[model samples]
Target: MFTKILIANRGEIACRVARTARRLGIKTVAVYSTADAKAEHVKACDEAYWIGEAPAAESYLHGDKILAIAKLSGAQAIHPGYGFLSENAGFAESCKAAGVVFIGPPTQAIIAMGLKSESKRLMTEAKVPLVPGYHGADQAIDLLREQSQTIGYPQLIKASAGGGGKGMRVVKSFDEFDAALASAKREAISSFGNDAVLIERYLQKPRHVELQVFADTLGNVVHVFERDCSVQRRHQKVIEEAPAPQMTPELRHAMGQAAINAAKAIGYVGAGTVEFLLDQSGEFFFMEMNTRLQVEHPVTEMISGQDLVEWQLRVANGEPLPLTQEQLKINGHAFEARVYAETPERDFLPSTGRVSTLIAPETNDFVRIDTGIRQGDEVSMFYDPMIAKLIVWGQDRTQALQRLQEALSKYYIGGLNTNLEFLGNLARSADFAAGDVHTGFIEQHMAELFPEPSTPPDEVFAAALWCELDHTQARASKAQRQTLDPCSPWAIADAWRMNQASIDPFEFQVGEALYSIQGMQRNGTYYLKLATGEKPLSGERIQGDEWQIVLGQKTLRIKIIQSGNTWLVFWNNKVWHLNLHDPVHEADDQGVHGGGLTAPMAGTVLDVMVKVGDQVKAGDALMVMVAMKMEHTIAAPKEGIVQEIYFQVGDQVKDGDTLLSLE
Candidate 1:
């Protein structure tokens, strides 16, 4: 085994690699950008090296800087985690040239699978089942259109070198073909520096099941079962599991053999994923092969009792295969839910801010949390917004789902909006629990998952009333203590008949809806009764200034503060700027609907597709902004003429900053 290896990545994957390296008695080195100078991954390594600035191109993507750091740190090998330079064939070749082992597949294998068009051709020769599509070298517009018609409508246009939903489009008709191809190519050029695309049949009800294949230097390749990554949004996986639910032994046997054949066809070594799109009719087609460790590899590790990273290290050291295909067996069902910092209700947009408070659930025999951050860690716009991955193992899928749901509820992130509720709902969905899932699961149930807020108006009222009562009594109790007697009449009591006038009436909005709340001091605690419900509420006092109240089975924890006439109740992960003004003092501050297009979050403008005075439709792309490595298109809000363009190509924009005007 190598004595030391440098992890050429950052965030949770870096930390994950260091953990596995420590188990193998190998010292680990970590490389970080300036933004991750004090990051958890840096702290977890034996030594840390500063690479470059915060942006990925200046830091994580700089292969030379990383190679220099590895050489200087006396690292014998380099482990490129999933993102950044992991699949860059040039980087792998450079490592070989420098006499430093790259703990992954050979450069030739990477290049073979890196380009989709070339890989499809290779798969065809290998006899691996492939979807019918166009991978020819002709880039002529009319020629591509002809191929699309040949392939059939409702086809997929994907970047030949794309991953993560970038440079991908699904066209349902021939009329939308030309525009989709252009847009996909533009995105492809920006994301992967390749405008070449391929057309393939788009299955309506498909499950993404990928086989985890590992091979040693001696040409011994074996399949480590499979993971069902069918739960996806925008073609990106959200939930994954190993030992796919309801998967038959015969199906597994055939798929495993096909995966081994695919890996061996490219002379693959180390850890790689052979992704297959399984149709509802029990037929599967080869999608593509990922030439590195995958993000959801943990679930496979838990079920197979294998450390894939250690396998990568051993394979890189030119070790022979330790196990054959017959040796591996699935132990149990495992699930991995990717916990992200985004709002599910607002179209799942990425959220950025400081994570003021992070309360992860207590771990047990069945639960594991792979995290790269802690409380006070800033979740900036500089990287991926994945907070952590919550993995759970059980004897079966039901038990695994139960453990996962419990863990999610206990997780508390204070500063930013997250999809905890969405995950929780998915865990309990009947269709999901029964394993009747597909790529369109979220799209089909979006309305049910993000229904209009069912939180009652009265619950908001009760929360406000309870908050005010707690504030009033605490203040009066303090004043009474300063008086001469220890047990004065004003001393805090649990149940004392209190005057209604002594307490305050509260009102707040939980969105666009309003509620009325009033509370009275009863005993030493505050009792609030909302107008919508007959049940009264009692607050659970915590610390000196905060109170937690349970209303309608959901807990509302708030920090109380007074700001002039309004009482700010920090609830629903936001500051509720309640209007406490009298009827005469209140002024309407209704929101206006018109404005120039605003950047949803901080990101770089990849393209300004339109300019000043350009005619636009309601959903026409004004520009594409790439933030946190995700592309978001700013579109026109209404059919109008473009009045102004405030940004240009390659401009870094902040959230809420206007990019253009449509009038």
Candidate 2:
């Protein structure tokens, strides 16, 4: 075993690797950009080194700097965790040249699988089932057009160099192929420094399943079953589960064997994932092979009872495989939900702010949370918005789903909006519960999932009301303490008093209607209760100036403050900044325009289409913005004349910064 290792990454993955290294008594060094100086990973490791600026290209992607740091720190090996330079064959070879071990597959294996076009050819030779499409390198527009025609319409255009939905497009018709092709090429060049593309058949209803394969230097390989990642949005996985709900013994064997063949064909070593697209007809096609650890590897870890990071370290040290393929057995169902700093209500646009308050779920038997942030931490605009990954395991899929829902309910985060509620909705969705999932699941249910003015359950509303009252009373008591003043003459001594009856009732609108509640002064505190007929439905607990409330399955610690004449209630990763002008009679304003082209998420602008006076249609591509390796085309909201452009190519933008405007 190596005595020291350097982690060439940051955020949660770096911290995660450090944890395993510590367990094995290996000292770890962390390499970080300026933006991550105080990041969790830096503090988690034994020592740290500054690399470069905040942008990945300036820091994490600077392989020369990373290698120098490794040599200086006396690190015997370097673990490239998942992103940045993880799959770069050149970086791996360079490490070997410097006499530093790379804790991943050999450079030859990475080179073989790094490019999609080349990798598909090798897989075909290995006899793995591949989707029927175009994988040729002839990038001539005319040649690509001819190839698309042969491959059939409704095909997918994918980047040859990288994955993660960047530089990928689905062209449903021949008329749209050219434009889609051009847009995809631009994004590909910007993101991966390669504009090469390949066309593939787009399965309209496909489930994404991937096999986890590990190999050691001695040619020993084993399959760790599969993970179903069909629940996705915009080609990015949202939820993943291991031991696919409906997988049969025969089908598992077939896919597992195919995955092993794919690995052996490349002489692969360490941890890699073989991804496949399973059609509705139960046939699976090899999509691509990720040459690094996957983001959702936790699900596989739960069911297989294996630590993949540790396996990577052992393989790098020339150790033989510990177990054979037959020794691996699937244990139970595990589900992982990615909690992001985005608002599902606002079309899942990335939201950023300091996490004002946070409380994770209490530890339980079947629940696990992997996170690297805390209260007052800023969800910066520099990188991915994934706050944490929440994982839960149970004996079956239904039980696992139930546990996930409960875990989400108990999770509390405040300051910015999150997708917790959206995740909960999906967990309880009938189609999802029935194991009917595909890549297009979110698009099919988009309307139902993103309805305007969504309302929480009535019980949830009652709890919010009770929490508001307790917050108000706490403020009053705090003010009294600061002044050392006597109690108000109007204060009630014990029970509800008539003198306090004159206090105005609080009213708020949830969804389409209005509701009212009143607080009763008792026991040196004010209590607000929702009465259903003669029975009280809920209450709040307030001691000193802190408040906590339980509503249905969710518990929240909230603060209520007055802004002008309106009241704002902050809880659970969001601030309900209500402009409380009227408790009833508000308009359902649909077309009221919000000014400017604010970035839907934080990202670097890849290209700007307009030049301050270009005529465009309602849905024309205004610009392409790249965030977390995914490219999203910012479109025009309406047909109009361009007034100004606030950004250009290569500029980093925040979530709500105006990119362009219309006159």
Candidate 3:
């Protein structure tokens, strides 16, 4: 076993690796960038070392610097968790040359499976089922177009050297072939530094099921069942479950064997994921293999009772497989939902800000929370925006789903936009509960999951009334504290006079729906008059942002956060972003309107399609900004001539900064 290992990663995966190292009594070293000096992963390790700036090119991807740090820290091995240098064949070879064990597949295995086109070729030779596609090495544009036509409509153009939807495009017709190919190559080169691509038959209704396979130095390879990652958005997984709902024993065996064949074909060692796309006819095709630990490995761990990281350590130390294939058993059904700081309503755009409030549900043997951030952590723009992963388990899928929904309700994140509401909706959706999932699940079932904003629920209005009253009391107390004569009401600068019949009028907006309520205090309870009727509401802050409230005769626990004039009411596994409809403030702020197009978030200007004196119509693309790896295009609001271009290409602009103004 490794006496010490340095984790060449950060965030949740880094912390996850440290956890297993601690259990095995192995000292762990962590490397951090300037932005992550105070990150949770640093504290999770036994020692820390500084690398470079926040950019990955300057820090995590510098394998030479990392190997040097491992040598200095006396780390016997290096664990490159998931991204960055995890799948870099050059890095693995460098580790071997440095005499430091790399706790992953050998360079041979990584090189064999690094390219999708190359891997598909090997899978073909290994007799693993493969989809009909073109995997040739011809990079000519004319030749690629010919191949696309040969593959027929609805074909997939995938980056040969990448995953994560970075350099992929789906063409539905021949007319769209040229543009799609160019776009795919552009994104492919930008993401992976390789413009080569392959064409494949894009199955309309396919499930993304991947088998977790392991290999040791003794040439012993075994499969750890499979995980169904069919629920996805933007071509990335959102929800994953193990043992795949309704998986037959025969199909499982066949897929498992095929996965093992691929692993052996590549001379694989350590942990690797063999992805397969199962069609509606019960036939499966080979997808690319991930050469490192996966982001959703927790689901496999929960069901198999295996610590995959520990397995990597043991395998690196030349130990044999921990358990034989027959000894492995599926204990229960498990589900993992990724919690990201993103706005699902806005095309899942990444949200950046400080996480002022992060209240997660309590975890137990059946529920787990894997996170590397505490409260007050900044969701930086320099890396992935995933906050934490919520994993839950039960004896069956039904029970596990019930646990998942309940756990999601108890999570509350404040100070930035998040997809908590979206996750809750997806988990509770009718189609999702019925196991009708695929890569296009979100798009097909979006109507039910992404319902239009409606009038505020009655409880939300009641919570709003409570918030206003609480704010009033807080203001009064603060005024009294700042007064010279605390004993005198006049010195307090408060004209506070209250009576039970005093009707406190309040109005707010949930989305565009307007709502108003009258709150009156009587006895120990407060009655609120909304559109429905008068209801008794009472609540008090129990601790932190939590509130214990009673509506009528029912008791509930919720959290309320106030930012500016907006109040987020966390109740019933949903978030209600309430904006107080103050007409005075609205009039004061709506004094001027302009034809200026601004940056939606802080990002670099990737392209400026229009310049000064350029005539454009509404909806014409003006500027493109890239932030958090997602691109947002600024469009013209109305027909006008571009009078001034404030920022050009390569300029970094903050959120809401005008990129160009129109006349």
Candidate 4:
């Protein structure tokens, strides 16, 4: 085995590779950008080096700079962990020329399967089942229109070199073909530097299933079963599982053989995935092949008891396959849920901030957490916003899924919005539990997934007040210790006296609503009064950061932490942040301008869909902005005439900056 290897990626994948390398007694080297100076991945490696600035183009994607660092650090190999430069054919070839092993498929294999057009032609020759589509090289608009008609209505226009849902469009009719084609080409060129596209048939309610295949230098290839990635949003996988819930033995055997054949046809080596779209009629069609490790490989690992990264390393060292196809068998069912720092209520918009507090669920032989972040880590806008991957295993699918729900409820994060609640809801939904999943799962159950917010119970509000009172007493006790006065009045709880009853009113704001609460202490007993009702309550600190509260006949144990002016309260698997309202200071609100359209997050303007004086209707696309490698289109709020455009293509804008105005 090689002594040391350089990881050419960041975030969880980098840390994941280092873990396997260390287990095999191989030294690991990590590379980071300016934004990741204190990143978890950097600290997980044996040695680290700074490559360039935060932008991927200047750092992670710079093949030459990474190669130079590999040579300087005396690394014998480089592991491209799933993104950035992982699938770059040119980078793989350069590594070979430099006498450093690239722990992935050969350069020729990458070129063969890198482009959609070329890969389809290759698969057709290999006798692999393919969907009916046009994979020709002609890029003329009229020619594409002709092909679209032949393919019938409701076709898909996919970029020849695209992934992650970028450079893709769905056309439901001929009338929408022209504009959709133009937009797809523009996005393809901007994202992948390839404007070429292919037309394919769009199947309804298809399940996305993929087989994990591996090859070695000795021309040996084997299959590692399959993973069902049907639950998706915006064409990206959100939940994945191994040994598909409804899969039959016959279908699994056929798919496994086809995947292995696809890999061998191109002389593939190392780890790769062959994706397929399973139709409702039990028929499957080839979609595409990923030339590197997949984002959801953990599900496959959990079921097969194999370390794919370790396999990649062994194969790159010219070793033969570790286990043959006959020896590999599925041990148990597994599920993986991708936890991201995003807001589901706002269409899953990505969020960025310093993680003020993070507490992951307890791990054991059955539950695992693959993450690169800890408390105080910053979720930046320079890369993907995936917080972690939660994986669970059990003797059966039902048990495994049940464990998954339990783990998600225990996961906690603060200082930024997240989709933890949304994920928990989906996991517990009746449809999901029954395994009625597909690519349109989220859209199908939108109402249940994003249910109307219910009014919080009085206990929650009382708990928030008790947390504040504890904080006040702790601060006062510290002050009393320094003054050498054991009987300092400041040490007593506020509004607590030996005389008559005293009611101390406190105000709090949650979201846009203000709540009024009064706490009364009389004869060593406490009562809380709100607009809704009154409740007798008592609270006592239990150890650190935990409290026991009694409301009438019910008792609850809650976790509370105060950071700045926000009080984070955890109860019954839910987290809430309530800001204490200060009467001394009031917020200044600027008058709302009806015609102003602003950017919701920091990003670069990719296109201005409208011009000054252009008439538009409500919900019309006005501009396109790219942030954290994802594209979002800003739309008009009402029908109006465009009066001004403040930013153009390539202009960097901050959050809440006005992009345009209408009249």
Candidate 5:
């Protein structure tokens, strides 16, 4: 085993690997960028070294700097955790050339499986069943168009060099093929630095099942069962569960063997995932194999009772497989929900902000949270928006799913948008509970899954107290915790007496609506005066972020996170953003989206389609902005003439900054 290893990655995976290395008595060296100087992963390891600037190209993707850092840290091996340089065959070769062990598959295996087109050709010779599509390197637009017709409609155009939905597109008909092709290529280049694409039959309702296969340098390979990642959005997985809900023993054997065969064909070593598209009729076709640990590997770990990271270290150290395929057994069902810092309402567009408050359900035998995010950490536009992965296990699927829902309820995030409520709704949904899941699970049941965007009064009431209460006086050290009265009228149980009592109305903005709430002490009782009407209410902070809200006779625990002027209220499993409404700032920003076209989030303008005094119709593409690997098209909201253009192509714009003007 390596006495010390350098983790050539960042975020949760780096922290995750560090944890396993620590448990195994192996010291870890963390490589970080400028943005991650104070990151959680930096503190998770014994030592941390700065590589370069924040952009991945400047830091994480620079293999030379990473190797130098490894040498400086005296790391015997380098673990490229999942992303970044994990699948880079050149990096693996470089590590070998530097006389440093790469804790991944051999360079030859990586070269064979790195590109989708080449990997599919190799899999074909291995007799692995594949979906019929165009896997050739002919990048001619006309040729690709002709190939799409040959493959038939409902085809998928995927980036050959990468995955993660960045360079993938679904074409429903001929008319949609060209635009999708161009868009997919653009995203592919932006994400993977490769515009090479391959066409495949898009299995519209197929279940995304993948097997966890481990191979040792000594040529021993074993399958660790399967995981169902059918629940997805925008071609990316959302929720994953192990021991697919309706998988039969016969089918499991077939897929497991197929996955093993695929790995063996590439002389694959260490941990790799073999993915497949399982049709409704039980027929499965091979998708591309991931040459690194998957984001959803926790589900496999939970059911199989194996530490995959440790397995990776052992295999990289030339140890044989820990157990035979026959010895490996599934213990229980497990589900993993990838909680992200994104807005489900806004088409799941990645949201960037400071994570002011983050609290997960207490981990026990049944629940696990793998995360590197800390309170006050900035969720920037430099990388993936995933906040954490929540995993739960139980003897059966039902118990595990129940635990998942319960755990989601306790998971809370503040000061930014998150999919916490969306994941909870998914866990509690009837269709998901009944095991009727597929790639279109989210879109198929959108209405029931997504509640109205408007914040309800209960949450607004929570925000009222969030801004009204002062938390500094409430927080007590452990030594003084016992002395503080839990039921004090000023702290927990009844309405707090205002230090400076007055009838001033508190102005709050919930979503787009503004409310003026007045606190009135009438007839020795308290009543809240709102724009809608008046209500008798009282509240106090019961614990950290949790407040006891009293509405007439009923009492409820509402989670509130206050950061500066922004307040994130978590009530009834949903989070509502509340800010003290400033009419002055509102008037200033009216032209942001009203008169002048504005950037939705911080990004560079990729295209500018219009100029001053140009005529455009409603819904016409005006500009394109790409940020955090996500592309957004700014369209004309109404038929108008372009009055002014504020930004040009390749110019950076902040959130809500005006881009162009229309009249």
Candidate 6:
């Protein structure tokens, strides 16, 4: 085995690779950009080096700079984690020329499967089952239109060199083919530097099942079963599982053999995945192959008891296969849910901010958390916005899924929007529990998945008041700290109420709704009154940042953290932000209002779709902003004429900065 290897990636994948390398007694080196100077991955490595600035093009994607760092650090190999430069054939070839081992498939294999069109041609020659579509090299628009008509309606236009849902579009009719093709091509060129595309038949309810296959220098290839990645949004997998639910032995065997054949046909080595689309009729067709370690490989590891990274290391060191195909067997069922820092209510837009608080579930033999963040870590706008991957294992699929739900509830994050609540809802949904999943699962259950916000229970509001009272008492005790008194009146709940009962009315706001509650002390007992009814309430601070509250027949544990003027209350696995209303210090509205377009988040303006003096209607795209690798368009709120344009393309703007004004 190599003594040291350089990880050519950052975030959780970098930390994940370091962990395995350390287990095998191999030293690990990490490279980071300016944005990740103090990142967890940097601290996880034995030695770290700064490559370039925050942009990936100037840092992570600069193959030459990474190669120079490898030489300087005396790293014998380079592990390209999963993203960035993982699947770059040129980078792999450069590593080989520099005499440093690349812990992935050979360059020839990567090139063979790099482009979808080329891969389809090769797979057809290998006798692999393929979907009916056009894989030709003609780039003419009229030719593509002809092909689309021949393939019938509801076809897919996919980027030849794309992954992660980028550069993909689905056309439902001939009338939409031209526009869809143009949009897909533009995205493909921007994302992958390639404008080539291929058309494929769009299946109504196809399940994405992929087989994990590995090969060695001696031409020994074996399969590690499969993972079902059918639950997706925007063509990206959100939830994944191993030993697909209700999979038959015969189908598994056939798919496994086909995957092996596909790898062998490309002369593949190291870890790779062969993806397929399983139709409703029990038939499957080849989709494409990923030439490196996958993001969701943990679920496969949990089920097969294999460390794929270690396998890649061994194979890169010219070692033979660890075990033959016959020796590998599935031990149990596993599930992996990707937790991202995004807003599900706003169409899953990526969110960026500092993580003020983070609480992860306790890990054991059955539950695992693969993450590279902690409290105070900033989710920047330079890379992917994924928070972590929650993996769980059990003796059966039901048990594994149940454990998944339990773990999600225990995970919590604050200071920014996240998909935790949405993930928990999906995990507990009846349809998901029953395993009725496909690529369209989220679309099919959109209503249940993104349900309207629920009103806070009365106990929750009472708990908030109890928290406020505790704070008041603590402050009073601190003020009286100079004089020590065993029977200080401040220590008593009703001490401030001298001879008569005191009723204090407070108003709070949650979102757009305002709630009013009155706290009263009657005969030394506390009660809260609302329009609904009156309830006796009591609370005690349990420890740091936690409190136990009792209201009527309900007992709850809540965490209350104050930020600025708002209090963040976490109860029953949900977070609520309550703002105290104080009329004394209220200020007049001075921010942007009426016909002004402001940025929703900090990002670089990618394009200005409208110019000054241009007329636009509601929902017309005015500009496009790119942040965290996702594009969000700013649209006109109502019909108006653009009077002024503030920022041009490539300008960096802060959150709430007015981009333009309409009259």
The whole-model lDDT of each prediction reads 0.82, 0.81, 0.88, 0.88, 0.86, 0.89
| Model 2 agreement with the true structure over 457-526: per-residue lDDT tens digits | 4444444556555455676666656663446654422234456542335676544555565544444444
Q: What C-alpha lDDT, on a 0 to 100 scale, does residue 556 get in candidate 3?
A: 78
User: Residue 305 error for model 6, in Å?
Assistant: 1.6
Mind sharing the TM-score for model 1?
Answer: 0.89
State in Å the error of residue 395, model 3.
1.2
On lDDT, the stronger of 4 and 5 is 4
Judging by lDDT against the true structure, name the best candidate: 6
Put down candidate 3 lDDT per residue, 1-663, tens digits, no spaces: 788999999999999999999999999999999999999999999999999998788998899999999999999999999888999999999999999999999998888888898999999999999999999888899899899999998999998988877778899999989868877887778677889999999999799999999999999999999999999887889999998987999999999999999999999999999999999999999999999999999999999999999899999999999999999999989999999988898788888899887778899999999999898988887788899999999998999999999999878788788888899999999888988888999999888778987676777777777877788778888888888887895754332355436567888877767777788766655688877778888888899877877788777777777766888787766767898898766633221158677666777787889878999998887887777766666778789999989898889887668778899
> Candidate 3, 129: how far from true, in Å?
1.2
Per-residue alpha-carbon lDDT of model 6 for 241-329, expressed as tens digits? 99898799999999999999999999999999999999999999999999999999999999999999999999999999899998998
The CA lDDT at 428 in model 6 is: 85
Clashing pairs in 5: none
With a 3 Å backbone cut-off (N, CA, C), the pairs that clash in candidate 1 are: 493-523, 493-524, 494-523, 494-524, 495-523, 496-523
RMSD of 2: 4.5
RMSD of 6: 2.6
lDDT minimum window of 10 residues, candidate 6: 490-499
Which residue pairs does candidate 2 place in steric collision? 413-573, 414-573
Residue pairs clashing, model 6: none
Model 3, global lDDT = 0.88
In model 5, the runs with Cα more than 4 Å from the true position are 453-509, 514-571, 575-595, 609-615, 640-643
Worst 10 residues of 1 by lDDT: 493-502
Residue-pair clashes per candidate: 6, 2, 0, 0, 0, 0
